[model samples]
Target: MTPAKTQFSLPDDFNPETLMVAKVTEFGVFHEVRRAAHLAADLVANGAPADLDLAEQILAQVLDRQEHDPADPHHGNFYWMREDEFVEDLNAVEFVLEALIPMMIRHAARLTPALQERLLAAIKLGLMEVARLDVLVAYTNIAALGVLNTCLGGELLQTPEIATRGFGKLLAWIDYTNRSGHPLEYNSPTYTAVTLRSLKLLTDLTADAPTRQAARALTARLGLSAALHIHSGTGRWAGPHGRAYQPTIVCETAPEVERLRAWLTDGTLPRWLASFVDRPMASFSIQETAERSRGIALTTHQTPTFALGVASQSFHPQANVLMLHYARPNAPRPGVLYSRYLLDDKWFGDAYHATDRTKMLNLPDEGRFLGVQEVNRAIGLYAQIGADHFASAKGVLIWTGRDEIDEIWVGEECITELPHRLDVDQAVVVARR
Candidate 1:
């Protein structure tokens, strides 16, 4: 049944007409439509006539689910999941295009006439929705991706108006980034990867010279920002991430690093940026600062053996404020030190567990102040007033390699437990390895 459900196989007893009903009707139906879309595209590209027919059927079913009501907010978008009939996924319209646009570009001639007409209409609808949403420049990843969707859709549909809007947004984003000294979602491992993919798509698909040039320059700048944070000894993204999940050592195999390497090798980036990526591991040390936005500042210090990163303040759900990563000989990854607040006994903003945002509290500007006094400062302190915010002032968390660290001290007391709550108003934390 369903060919034993290989990674991309459709469900057994699946019918193009009733798949959605069956999914909702059944208790644990397990089909991944996104993977199926990619699979269908692959089959259409290279499979036999029977396979091509099967691919078309899958694509047709997917297309039927797009919301088509002119008055609906999700007019051109698909549900985040098939069972979701009412909710709208804001990012779905462009992301679905990521799979669909390339198919039209490469295999439009092969598709049957009816399928081609339907596909063309769907792309146009999605493009119009993207223009209506008009994501702001500050929301970096989606804004970059929206630009690509509109520009590419315009090119595909021979609609100059859509292309013009896309280009205007692109220029505005460039201006905002230039003024801010960094992308608004700066140094994010997860989102930077998404932005890189979108930038690459714009450079590859759009014929507009100015848009292509702008995308290339932005790609190069983001690449350099990443290269500076990569610790030579540990081969990890040295932190103070504007947005990141729980993982401490995001490595070379990560999507962002892979994309950065691809951009660096193309020979279009500046020589210095490329050279730094190719540079040998040696006694290197440097401090970098960026005016993150109007009021916040980010500073990072990286050496061959260790790295320390701090943000003056942040509001991101997973902001990595005051992070330290150090080398550990023969270990798979680096030793780590980072801060996490405790809210109602749960780690604040813990990505692993679903936490309630309403009950959780954020630090006030005066309370959230964090910094490293000097470039190589080993001892650092984070001040937070817990009276206003219901969360407790939990001190730093540490993960050490074999023999990397024997003890940690918060003020004068040796910390015996992890994530110790410092009782005083100001606590100085130190990690000794």
Candidate 2:
């Protein structure tokens, strides 16, 4: 049977160049954040992020007295804990909480007033925590405030303290650059793009000229326009390990678009473009091996055969089982074969030594063999490998014909029911020529 057709929606004003830029930038930031979380967790665990003498000094002063106490009952004793253990867990929690703060605030206006107030309190607490640790809260925090401002309309902006703190943070990120030991690691092109967007939003909300100029200056300095062009077109970024980094899409906004446009036209593209080129690919196959002796004879041509065709191969090296398709040449076949290798001579000799009913049932090799779940997994693996290899071979089986059967197909019902079988455990591949 033929597959059903799929449909997709397109934007009214779709431009490939603009869309590409937006997509790359958005994805880049997402990738950076994910990487940062992992990196931060590792660094914290190693006692690196909090090991800095200056940052620790600042943290010591900023934390409450209870936090520093060796035996405070209410403080949870988290601050006084060993740096290695505490930092890793704390950094992970902080990363998640920091990320959630902006996300919660962004969706706050759509929620009930109680939820909005709760989210605001959460954001404030998160901000204080991150600031106390000297961690920079950038575009995410700025965007969260933008959402809150939009929701609250003019009332919240009327407060000078709120306005000053929000605008100040936004401006600081705009001018932010890597300096001293504090690395200005912009997560992705998208992050910078989003920051530009937040600045635009701030300018729109308060008509702040200085913030607008700062945003423009940041765009010029970062060469965001050129970066966007390169990223959207053919440019690539490589990580420290010489692996190409592919960004994931997350945020798409007007400011991001503008920044991308500017990056393409301007000459400030980053040097990491060389890392995005094509790489290599690999594939694998399987074969059957056996031993022939007088009474221990086991050949594929032998009659009363308890053998079957090979089903699937695994991508990983440690995986041992192979799925078998039990469909006959013309009959409406319903069964599947799960062949397992007998590692021990004692088990094989005792199990298949005789066809006695009682003996066969009691044999460990026969009874404790392949399970149903394994048989199903093998079938699924067969389908996956088949499809991938089929496409790779340009719709033709490359290794089949003369002496080797390169490809095979199975019925839909057999594949579906293979998983639900109760008798079989892990499936194994055996020769059945």
Candidate 3:
């Protein structure tokens, strides 16, 4: 078959100005990720009925999709509509190949060594292929291979090769994230859950390997970084500060989600990973410039009743601003977010995405939570955002609004600039749900 030519012309109505194509995923694959993940979790928890029959069935489904044409055309083909699909695909591979396949081979009686070898070869090729296209995802793909090598054999196919690079890079990323105090993986709202699953896979797969100790350390540090957002009252996520969330089928109905719920409700990660995390800290702080050059500086304060994720800038010119989460106890993983902005709840209503980037302060950070406002520049319309350190019970943000913009925003939703040039200070308090 002749290679398909790639060509496209923007339509007359297409607005290049409005298109932020990088944020979109041309296809969705997380449903299978979640399903495959749940199957693995179930097998781990308790599922040896008939030599792990249920687990085997799930593994077969994943392998079949490995070669089959996906319902979404972008998935099967080498070419992609956008780069994030590459991310989606590699993440999918992490769930199935890195995650499910290893668990099955380790425990399930039905998955033979011969079958495992075939799957490993195919996965290796996919990682190489995708690496050629997008190296970032390849970084993760290498970690996936490391995991495969760990479960299948000590001296597996790619040992001391791509496996080493992948493990090393991932550890470095964890180190940078923790040390710099910057939000990671795009500083995405749903990222904590997404990343937690991956770390869990890596940690569990390499249980006996040389990399296990480092992997466990990275996992613990990452968990702490993410846990800063868990709310004590509502147990929901804070808000989408970076990219707005892409729809994923990894929902509450998933068995894995249920398992996580059970664990968060009364337990920590399986004893091994949990050994370090131990108990939730009273409060921890994170302040840094994010990895992708996006600006983010935030702090988390956890009281027995409320875990507050606090930040200076909720929106900035370069970085997606931070949104704080104060969750109810035992709510759920990736719980509903506590809003950071004091929006007109009657006008805008209390929604999860409400705390997204609105026209706000562009306070650049020099480090350690101080965003200096010059009064001349702004992220969009708002001039500056900073936390009022005077009070402790509620969140108080001191903001300097744009004085010249008059009535800022498009129309009815538009906010009127403050009559005065000084910062408008208010307290951000979370209610007990």
Query: Each candidate's TM vs. the true structure?
Result: 0.78, 0.29, 0.50
> Per-residue CA lDDT of candidate 1, range 293-314, in tens?
4465667777778878777665
Q: What are the lDDT scores of the predictions, listed in order?
A: 0.66, 0.28, 0.39
Best by lDDT: 1
Candidate 3 lDDT over 324-426, as tens digits, reads 3333345343232322222122112222221222222122221122232212111212322344432222222321212212343332244444332323453
- Candidate 2 accuracy as lDDT: 0.28
| C-alpha root-mean-square deviation, each candidate | 6.2, 23.7, 14.2
Model 1 lDDT-worst window of ten? 350-359
For lDDT, candidate 1 versus 2, the one ahead is 1
Where model 2 places Cα greater than 4 Å from the true spot, the runs are 1-109, 136-159, 162-183, 186-209, 223-433
lDDT (tens digit, per residue) of candidate 2 on 215-308:
4455444443223222221111110000001111111123233444443344222234222111121111212211111111111110111112
Stretch of 10 with least lDDT, candidate 3: 372-381
Enumerate clash totals for all models, in the order shown.
0, 18, 17
